[model samples]
Target chain A: MSNIPEELHYSRSHEWIRRNEDGTVTVGITDHAQDLLGDMVYVELPEPGQRLAAGDECMVVESVKAASDVYSPLSGEVVAVNDQLADTPELVNQDPYGEGWLFTLQPAEEGEPEELMGAESYRKLIESES
Target chain B: MTLKTALYEQHLSLGGRMVDFGGWQMPLHYGSQIEEHHSVRKSAGMFDVSHMMIVDLAGERVREFMRLLLANDVGAEPRPGKAIYSCMLNEQGGVIDDLIVYDRADDGFRMVVNAATRDKDLAWIDRHARSFGVDVQARVDLAMIAAQGPEARERVMRVLGAEAPAGTETLRPFQAAWNDRLFVSRTGYTGEDGFEIILPEEEATGLWQRLHRGGLTPSGLGARDTLRLEAGMNLYGADMDENCTPLESGLAWTVAWDPADREFIGRAPLETQRSIGVTRKLKGLVLEARGVLRSGQRVECGASGEGVITSGSFSPTLGKAIALARMPSAAEGSCRVEIRGKMVDARIVKPPFVRNGKSCLQGSPTDE
Candidate 1:
């Protein structure tokens, strides 16, 4: 079973979002997503300040087995991107929720984050997927 | 329903991530694929290769039947315990499959063919065998295990018990020696010194467990792919299929043209192609930039002509991307690979990129 943090919000595409104090959100893929992809060899992060539409493919995570596109969970402007993944992509596999966060987003709409799935629903989603 | 190998239960117990491969449920990895790859290169590792179909051919005319059925000559006389790698071709000069044949003495030969091509290969062999009155017996009761890398032989020998064959330490490459029912061959796909053992299916799990206890890491198909790719080996379906011939797949050396009178299947078309010269040739690629090259990616050869990557990966041995591509025979010098819609410069080099657990290409220092 994969760990699902009770506080984090998740999208159907497997990206997790955590609301911050200033209303900006931190985002990354879930542990289950990284586990399915295996050891990551490279990570292409979206540029900070770039605008993204909901569900838009913004980055790529290349594992040893295959490359996967990371989609934006909600429309927003990229507030910050994880530069540490440039040399150490394995961090996504090691700590997917913490230090492995791909980027932070300032949401285009305040209600967009609520449209994402809660922890309980996301748990069922991954359970059905497995 | 997916087909299961004899060691399917063992793989599940050992944390193997199961995946569907060639209609069989096989392990993709037993934890971390990269760690398993490193284990094989630095020490020893074992892979359950029971999915590969083994067929035994027995008869007075078995050698003659092989000569007619395969593109490569089986020689005038079969040499006992000598394994020859060859490609089986259709009448159209397209490769049916690439296989290894072991002459097992007593006018008998044993062949190991790819799992996906098992049905076709058997049908082809049987169709040709009817004229020679030879017996083509599928050895489904047997299982195969490959123990590879630097310390592979030593670790396997430690657990092989007293019945293990004597002088196994001195068994030359491409040679096999049997100890009772156990057939151990000094050949492998990983480009490392090791043994590929074929034994009864019932004994497989026990042998695998002993090897694991004896310090041989249990690897899976995921590492197997990367290892073979780094070694510059051709995968049956990815590298070549029934639509392509060995000449264009970097397997010309495996085809024997000696003793001119030897007429094998596809001989006429191959001879014509040989005379006319080949257009595309399989070559190796080393990405000069940051990116992972994958199969089906386009190779931009500028005026030299375009090609496609047959097999590509991030070489764990070199810490960079490497691939095998079928490019124009006239393709000289360097080329660019269009990876993810971007052209990345790649150095064209002869294959066997990593051999004996070391880099064989020039300019790159061997990582010890």
Candidate 2:
């Protein structure tokens, strides 16, 4: 079984979102997503200040076996990116929820985070797929 | 339905991620592929290679038949237990499959071929063996395991103990020692010192457990691919196939043209190609930029013509992406590879990028 933290929200594409106090939303791949991708070797992060629409391919996570695209769940402007992944991509595999966070975004719309699936719904989605 | 090896249950118990490979359900990884690859390079790792087809050829005219079947001159090594790596070619000089043939002395010759090409290879061999009055028999009852790395031999020997053949300790590379229970060969695809042991199917689980207990890490095909690629070895379907000839596939060394009169299968086309010189040749590439290189990616060789990446991956050993590309024979120096719509620069280096746990590349950390 994969770890599904009750505090975080998730997208169907497997990105977990955490709401920040300043209206910025932090995003990273879920533990289930990382497990499927295996050992991450490289990560391509979107530049800060870049704008992304919902369901846009925002990042690329490469493992030894294959490369996968991480899509943005809510429309937003990228405020910050995870520079640590440039050197230590395995951090994504080691800690998908905490230190492995990909980037932070300032949401274009205030209610977008609530529209995303909660932890229970995300767990059910992954369970059905498996 | 896919076939399962005798170690299928064992793989599940060990948390192996199962996948379909060449019509067989096999393990892709046992948690982490990079760790498994490193284990094979630094310590000892074992791979269940039972999917490979083993065939025994026995007859009074076996030597004559092999000379006609293989691109490499098997006659060069007549000593029993000696192994020769060769490509079985078609009439057009295209590689049918690459295999290792062992001279089994009085018992005859034993060959191990790729699992995916089993039917075709067996059919081709059967078709040719008829005229030579040789008996071709597939040994499905046997299971093979490759234990590789610096300490692989010591670990395997400790696990096998008295079951190991008497001459096993002195066996050189490309040599095998066999008793009734086990056939241990000093050969591997990972460019590491190790043994490929073939034994009865029923005993595979016990041997695998013993080797595991003796400190041999159980690796899967995922690690196997990375290890072999880093070693600069070619994969059958990816690197070369029915459309590609040995002369163009960097396998010219395996083709023996000596003794002029030796008219082997596909010898004519190979000779003709050699006379005219091959247009495209296989070369190794090291990515100079970040992104990973993948198979089917276009390679721009500038003045030399466009080529394609035959095998490409993120090399866990080198910490960079490396690939085998079939490019114009004249291609050299720097080239550009198309990755995710962007042209990335890469350097053309000689194959065998890493050997014996050290980088073979010039200016690499280990080079000094």
Candidate 3:
């Protein structure tokens, strides 16, 4: 079973979002997504201040097998991008939720994160996929 | 429905991720593909290669049949137990498939062909063998395992123990030693010292288990692809198919054009192409920028000409992306590869990017 923290929200495309006190949300690929992708070789992150619509392809995560696109779960402006991934992409595989976070996003609208799937629904989603 | 090898159950037991390859359900990886690749380079690793079709040919006219059928000179190595790698081509000089043929002396010859081209290869062989009265039999009852890496031989030899044939340890490169049940060859797709063992189907699982128990990493097709790519080897369908010839696919060495009188299939067109000069040829590419190089990507060689990447991947050994691309002969030094609509700089280099667990690239950024 994949790790699904009770406090985090998930997207259908497998991105996990954590709401912060400053109203910005941090995003990263879920553990299940990293596991499925196997080893990470390169990661292309969205630039800071870049605006993204919901479901837009904001990033690309490449594994040894193939390259995959990471979509934005909600409309937001990229506030911060992970710089460590440029040299140590394996951090995405080693700690997908914490140190491997892809970026920090400031939401364009309030309560957009709540519209996404909750931990229970995300667990069920991954369960059905497996 | 996809076919299963004799070791399907074993792969499942070892947590292998199964994927559809050609027509068979084969393991893509046991766990981490990079780790498996590293294991093969650093120590020992094994691959279940039973899906490769083995065909046996016999009769008095067998030698004549092979001479006409193969692009390589099978007669060059008439010594028994010698293995010759060749491309079976169509009349138009396009590659039908690449295979290995082993001379069995009085017992005739044996060939191992790509599983994806099994039916086509059989039909082509059968159609030509008829006039020569050569007996063509597909040995589906046999299974093959490839043990590769520097320590692969020692581990395999230990596992075989007294059951191994005499002189098995001393088998020369591209040579085979066999008895009634087992055929062990000192040849492998990976650029490493190892053995390719062919035995009866029923004995495959047991051997696989024993080899694993003896400390051979159970590798899968994922690692196999990366390993072969780093070794500068070509994949049959990816690198060359019916539309491409051996001369253009960096396999000119495998084709024996000497003994001009030898009339092999596709010889005339190959000779004509050789005289006229081939416009495009296969070349290796090292991505100078971030991102993976994948098959079907467009390669822009500026004034030279445009081409496509036949096979490309993240080279675990090189710590960067590399590819086998078919480009115009004039294209050299550097080229640009379009990765997701962005043109990225890439360096043109001779392949065998990694061999014998070390980087072969000269002055490459990753070279240490």
Candidate 4:
């Protein structure tokens, strides 16, 4: 099972978004996703300042054994991406909620992050999946 | 249709991600595949390899039969419990299977074959043994677990404690020993020092829990593939199957053509191929990519026409993508791989890209 922090909201695709005090939503994969994929070898991130549509593939994470895309949870303008993943991708597996965070974005429409699940809801989803 | 091993219940209890590999429901990983890969490379990890079929062949002529059946001759004098790695071949010189033959005693040799090829291998052996008068018994009651990596042996031995047998102390590579009903062999898949233990299926959970308590991480097949690739070990299905000859799969060293008079199923055709030289050969490719490399991806070796990657992955130790490719015989030096519709440049490199957690490939053509 993967770790899901209680303070964050999660998308069905296994990404977590932490609404920061600065109004940007910090995005990263859930500990569950990283655990399933194994040791990450390469991480491709979105270029900051780019506008993104909800559910768009904004990044890619490649484990030594498999590769998968990181989809955006909400429509927004990309504000930041952790460039450190280029050389230390395993951070995603080791610290999915902290230093392993993928990117940050500013909401474009000031709208709700609809369809996003809270920690309890995500846990239920994981339970139902089992 | 066969029954699951003893770890079946435990796998489900631990929330293992299961996949049907070669018709067996096996754990791909518990959660993080990358962590599992690193755990073995850096610490220790264990795998459930019970799906590999084990057959014990007992007969008076076991030695002579194996000398004729396998690519590597194990008929040479050997102490009891010594194991030999060999390949079974077809009459056309193509590989039937690669197997381990354990010279358990003068009375018999035990053959461990790939799970997917169990039926065909059994049929082949039975058909060819018509005159050998051997008793072939498939051992369904046993399960196999391989503890691998630098700390694998120590962790496993710690768990076994007094159960670790004397014969295993000075056990040479591929040697086996049985003590208190547990069989331990100095063999592994990770290209690291380790041991494989075969025991009653019911006892697997006990050992698994012990190893878990001892901190031997439970890794899945996903990590196994990457580890074997880094070790330059050929995967049976990907690198070569029943349709490909060992000669073309970079396993020619396993074939013994000694005495010049001994006859084997594939000898005639293999001899012919050797004389004319193989048309296609397996080679390693290190990609200096703008993206990832994967199997079934076509490789364009400039002027050598098309080739294809059989197995490929990002090498954790090297921090780059590597692949074992089947390419034209004349192919050499450099090549390009078609990834996501792009022709990404790559270079031919010697395999064993990493061994024992150290990088073996350097100066890879990353510039192009």
Q: Which residue pairs in candidate 1 collide?
A: none
DockQ of 4: 0.45
Stretch of 10 with least lDDT, candidate 3 chain A:
A110-119
Q: Name the regions of candidate 2 deviating beyond 4 angstroms.
A: A113-115, B366-368
Off by over 4 Å in 1: A112-114, B366-368
Local error of candidate 2 at residue B227 (angstroms):
0.7
Best by DockQ: 3
| Chain A of model 3 scored by TM-score | 0.96
Go through the candidates in order and give each one's DockQ: 0.87, 0.86, 0.89, 0.45
Selected candidate, larger DockQ, 1 vs 3: 3
Candidate ranking under lDDT, highest first, comes to 3, 2, 1, 4
lDDT tens per residue, model 4, B175-265: 9988667888998878888889989888899988889889999888888888989888888888998788988998998888896777867
- Which candidate would rank higher by DockQ, 2 or 3? 3
Which residue pairs show collisions in model 3?
none
Relative to the true structure, candidate 1 reaches a TM of: 0.98
Off by over 4 Å in 3: A113-115, B365-368
